[model samples]
Target: MQAVNGRILIVDDDPIQRRLLEEAVKKFGYRSKSATNGAEAVRIMTGPEAGEIDLIILDMVMPELDGLGVLERLRSDKIPTPVIVQTAHGGIDTVVSVMNAGAQDFVVKPVAPERLNVSIRNLLKTSALEDEITRIRKHASGTLTFADIITRSSAMERVLDLGKRAASSNIPILIEGESGVGKEMIASAIQGSSDRRNKPLVTVNCGAIPDSLVESILFGHEKGAFTGAVDKHVGKFQEAHGGTLFLDEVGELPQDVQVKLLRALQEGEIDPIGARRPVKVDFRLISATNRRLIDQVKDGAFREDLYYRLNVFPIWIPPLRDRIEDIPALTRHFIARFAAEAGKPQVAGITPDALDLLQQYRWPGNIRQLENAVFRAVVLCDGVQLTAHDFPQVTSAMDYPAPSGVPSNSAPIATPAPHHAPAPHTPGTQISEPIQAEQPQSGFEHQAPFGFMRNLDHDGHVRKLADVEEEMIRAAITHYSGRMTEVAKRLGIGRSTLYRKLKEYGLDDNGKDAAA
Candidate 1:
């Protein structure tokens, strides 16, 4: 979908200037949010919707809190959103003051759309590059702690708490989770938070290794120990000496290897292939698996004694759907990372409706699937903000209908992959393919006109008034660029009532009423 190029907060006291700037932002393929004065702008920059805002257009002449004041507040709060200050008189003194106060750029009051677009684009590009650099540096340092994890769910909090307690010791840790639930990240965090924080973290995926080579790969091998054994090898255990050894998919290890692994854990040493004696090793053990080790033990696929050793301090991570509360933060994090990586710094955040749609789906592939989806959306999206139409696969997989007014820039809908053989056809007879029949478009098909809301359901029955009201409010907010005053006035509701309805409907930026 053609997401808005970016979300620009317009902090201008003058209604005319705000409206004009909003229109210009829209024209430039970006979305705009309004703040009556600098104070409101600061509130927004520090509030729940902060991450979604890619840039700000600040007017210098606002009362209560001027553009310079806003810049100071943002700086003190460490908000990195780029700001473009606007003043009626673009004198050198005013420009210098704003820049000194942390403004990224300055524009004359009657800012031309072209000039404004260029300024916004350049700042976003620079900011994205800086963010990507910081992320890479943090990863390379291997100091990723629990704080680096983006989560707001209580379930994840418990996991982090358990992980923190477990990190205090070198006890064998078994992190159990479905595939892609970030088991490796948890393992890394454990190692990074442990005494071995400055040491190496050697990881081996047991499931990805061949059965014949599992033992040799984990415990090392001597030259000529087996066919084609050309040189002495230091295995994962040796490589992780004085550090940590993370065995991912540990449940997949062969039965024979499990015995040696148990012995190594118990004896604090390993007997490498063709070695004269056991070699001492000092490494922390962290194992992860998608399957239940208990089940594997019962099936005789895993040794029971080895299972108990690894399960000493088990930590289970919940799947994505169970922690839907984390979706907004995670989505924003991925958007930032992928947007930077894709060199589309202007691609800032996803619309609230898009976030809601994502939170509703059961992500069977978990965080890995979510990460990949955001990466794809960042690449496919042409606008600054991602919309529901950006995730066509998610929309199609969940059978979700596209929002009524948002136009899609996606490919044509393809039929699902077949799971069964095609039905038999008569010889020399033409048979109409049922799968080729016209299907309702979810997010990929060319959309209908904009500014119209669907009043009826697919069954032709009138939709509930509550649903229609919520949809109307959402559209009004998007249409007005989150100017609540304008939205309430247009909807014939008082501002307080509008805010109340927003709370009741759970339609604020973070998918809930931040004001409430």
Candidate 2:
């Protein structure tokens, strides 16, 4: 079952019943409070403690004002909270009446904790879905254009085109690429291009939010819902009403959260913290990740249901290495941009050799690294053009050959050049030789073969063999286009073993070939 965020408010005229419900919420790892009547509940809901509540358990029959009456007040006042009605009266008419009155779901007086939990989960799921629908509607009518992105690659251009089409439709979109490949930018572009441009584009970094706050962040809470909640704070779902909600690093969302998120997509409403009702929202969901989500589902880190919901339309951004041809255009674009920004008209362009060096190197960090490199070069350039000497040699280290006369037994061996033997001279001939010294390897030695791995050794300990093995495995997978079976065979391991290794390395094989 799905896990709901833990801020619940229990309202019952009977003290015993309210206490029982409160205890149940606590037993299930939720934080909750109790109210003797609907008036008290609403007062607490709108008070200083408003931001901590996620759901409300309201008793239908009570003194002073009935549950339906309270729900009407909430709706009329525009209070966005999910309310579940509880009544000793267990008739279809009663359930239907309360439901039509804006209650998300209704439960009998002798409700089981499991049943209550299930209803709450379903309500929260529906709340999220409604929010997504609202966001989509708002974005579809908005202004999303390609001019917002900073890139010259045709790959990016295609992405923008796809984004425009996807934004216009209600279909869910899955954006896949390496980290720092601008997946979020694509999502933003889609939002901008859609009808909901006037509405807020809420962003939820699935990887950044702690597991505990995932529910409250998505569905919002009522006032006094928790210990620290000073006031009501709308969640991303509510905040994105009639707009777009982008879930970045979606693969990192916890398993339980995935289930609820899936339900929200299936439904179209969300149960807010301490809310006695589920609010309907209209929003679009645009999700992005560097991970292969299908693999995560297979490995049980992500839900299969959620995967299907998000995979309706997929857009994969090619890495810089795959689109090396775009490097020159990108370099010139960035040079002009940085030069103008830095007020450096004298530094007009990059030397051909410098451009060649950049084109030859493999960019593991993708476009982000390339942009940084250009920015660094622009800042350091002293003349009208940036030459190979001005540009850092470390940029080309991955493709450089090793120096001659180095021992083969060196801890790390570099590639050797072929077919360049010098002619032998007679002894004491005193022949003058054209001297060509081997380029120094010190600068290159410390540079990681790919990207960020180089900086990990600042404390001066060699990376463990396991780390090396994992890097090689990842490199092999990338080299083979995420073909796991091919990688397994190359590594001389079984497919199962390879899968286990991938889990161990936190790698997923959904986008690329998992079966070779």
Candidate 3:
């Protein structure tokens, strides 16, 4: 599915033209909210839904507030939504005036659908690219702050709050999250938010370095300190002096190195190899690891003392699957970036169905996985918008039917049946499937189609409330792969209530909850 093209606000007084424009916008794969006049348009743009409106199609002439007036109001309010002005007169002066008033593009009245779509696509693409470029610059300059984090989920908001609090002082911070949940980005933001802005944020991936080289690499060595140490070397700690040092995958450090790391954090200094005395280094420490350091400590793989020293202020970033609400925004951000990098200016947005497919999958690799997926989709996309067909791997994993007529070099994506089972005779084995213990006790043996609940009974009347409720419970169980906790949370009910309903409906098989 193509990403949601964008939300457009159409402002015009003529009812016929408004309806026509609305139809054209819908046909162009964009969702739109309409305003009868310019004043109403301004209100919508400044109201709570302002962020949702991506572009505006304003009539040049309207009562109370004209196109130029609306542009002035938006500019004064610092609302930068791209605008396209339309007028019946195609005078050069009108075009120039609209351009000067901050409209991105101008169109003649009774605009051709093709031309209008091109304008909207170009404007949205330009806006997305500009935002992406700004983010890239901030990230590269080590000036990225919490405000630069692209997120819309409440789960991430808590993470940001903790990061902000940790940034106020030189407290040791340990960022805990799965790989690719943006731990390094969090560390960078903390550094930028603190007094160390514009300072070096030296990152060392502990796991990526060889065990023999880890010690020397982290602490500078004098010339001829070892057999291969011919030249003096500066270590990560010294490089991060007066700034921030981010130790990624710090759990992988050798036990001997752990002792030195603990001492360095505790003493605010390090003993360089072959040095006359220990060198005092002043730097903030921020460590990140995908593994639970406590578990490593329990297993005696990581030193307990070192773990405690590094974990002064623990901030756990929720995984992408846990913060599913952020997928759409993150998807768009990645699409914009990759499209710009790939020079695919025409590739603007994704279809709603495509976005839905992405949200349904559990991204075990977190944000990194999503970013790669969007990058690949953008590269594969031949049209202006990305569709479900572009993400064949994801679809196949979910057992979704491959879109008709699109060619693929990989194995065909499977089609799910009404019972939520993949059709047989496919070459590729199914990755995972929804758990089904036994036939549901509700006795609607003929299952409603997968992903759709029955709204009417066999007699053409509305289904019984209890039956519908039972179907919903069953569907939720399957959709979440029998993870009762997630199912309950998504269903907006307490776990106890969910379990009771499962027992009441005879949907629970013994021991499923224990494993889940």
Candidate 4:
């Protein structure tokens, strides 16, 4: 990879020291800019040229405004550019003050080129990571007010209305919905419209991470905190120190991680894994889950206090089936979007019958699934408008049976390592090897041995614990709104175990009877 280039701004009242530092910075292949005093540095930073300067070297005793003053201004203005303080005072108090003032790094007076260079390189690396995250989140780009949502249904309008009111408050927000129901979209809209719109809105996907990495990912860790922990990582909370931290799939958080997260939320502080002290953070919290956390709390899988804390401003987004009135408007918006993305701007709209078919159907995957269908149609279409033929699956979807726990708007399905594939069956084919055809065989030739707890009926005949355990597992699943991750967690079993039980019990995620 090519070396990361950066622009350095030198701020010192003394032209002699400033010129020396500028030349030293240039010698290291970094472009340099100069500021006569701290005041000038603040102006340039808060002005048009702010984005150009990656690192600032500010002298503490500048005539007009000192180092601390400039740092304070930067902090107040929320400028994330890294600053290195140059102070004659090498006292510990001065160093602490600089850090407290939000300066990223500092060096003692008569700055050594080597020491300054090292600090700059480290800060720039961390800064680059943060910048990339910020670019992806796009604090301002993905932001939405209620206006951006295309909904005609009053039910959805109420959700957007409450979201609008919630945007003005700093209270914790809990969004509940089925998967692909636009929970993150609502959370981002709230963050962007809130008072801290200019600050970062960091998102954490709780279920996406491995259990072992949960604590480190959410609370961060110091360098050498654990094996393979090479550098200090500021967690999601710190990343959105003044804005918002949206924890998606929060119910999937492990017991240990939930404990630490509870403490952080309650105390407004976090103890990084290897840090000497706890770091204080002040940010709004937004959590989303398709599962009912209240049920998980009852099952002892989730903390009661954390649930209460997050549910302060509860907003439930109704599923697509419940608010089908919004389908047409949503379809228009998505077609326009996917068409432009696919470089087919001339695509006018969907056919009237096609729109009717979409409205008539119950979208199990919600808005996310709808978007995928539209995008796929736009990419494959050869006409100016999409027809029912464009979405052949939609016509057949009514009769299609969905698999357990997999959303219609699901991400790419993970193909597990196959133990075996089913044998091909031809019409009128008969197996004569095993002639007892009345008893059916399982699809898999090799079934993993499942231990069962035996029980006796009132008649005293022995029976497997299958009936009792199946009821409990099925009830837990229904109560938790069919979130298998939370179900497995509450049932004190691994996810693979839960899958086995679900299949063994003939249960699906329909929130009703058995799959058969």
For this target, which candidate reaches the highest TM-score against the unseen true structure?
3
Instruction: Give one digit per residue, the lDDT tens place, for model 1 in 111-230.
Output: 778788778767765665566566456555666678666676777777788889889999888887667888888888888898899788888999999999998999999999889889
In candidate 1, which residue ranges exceed 4 Å CA deviation? 1-90, 101-133, 339-346, 400-516
Highest lDDT model number: 3
Better of 1 and 3 by lDDT: 3
Residues forming the 10-long window of minimal summed lDDT in candidate 4:
443-452
Model 4, 216-289: lDDT tens digits are 88889999998999999988878989888999999999999888888888899999899999999998999998
Candidate 3, 1-516: lDDT as tens digits: 343456799999999999999999887767789999888998998897886787899999998889999999999998888999999998999989899889999999788999998898788877777777877798788899997787766667777887888899998887876678899999999998999989999999999999999989999899988898899999999999999999999999999899889899888889888888899999999998876565466468999777777766777676676677678768877888898889887788887788888887777678998999999999999998889999987887677322223221111111222343233221122111211223111111232212435444544455688877776766566555456787789989999998888777765532123324
Error of 4 at 500 (Å): 22
- By TM-score rank, best first, the candidates go 3, 1, 4, 2
Q: For model 1, what is the C-alpha lDDT against the true structure?
A: 0.74
Q: Is candidate 2 or candidate 3 better by TM-score?
A: 3
Candidate 2's residue-wise lDDT over 1-516, tens digit each? Answer: 222234688889998887888888866545588889989988987785654565789999999988988898888877677898999898988888898888878888799888986676555444543443454454454444554454445555666667777878777777776676777767877777767666677888988999889988988889988878789979898888888889998988877777667767878788877888888878889888776554355456777667777876777676676566567546655666676677775665555667667766666677888888888888888886666666674344433332233211122221221123223222222122212222111112221223223212233344567766676666556544455787789989999988887777675663222334
Off by over 4 Å in 4: 1-142, 399-516
Show where candidate 2 strays beyond 4 Å: 1-144, 147-157, 340-343, 402-516
Tell me the lDDT of candidate 2: 0.67
**Every candidate's lDDT:** 0.74, 0.67, 0.77, 0.71
How big is the positional error of residue 405 in model 3, measured in Å on the Cα after superposition? 33
List runs of model 3 lying over 4 Å from the truth. 1-5, 9-52, 62-65, 76-79, 400-516
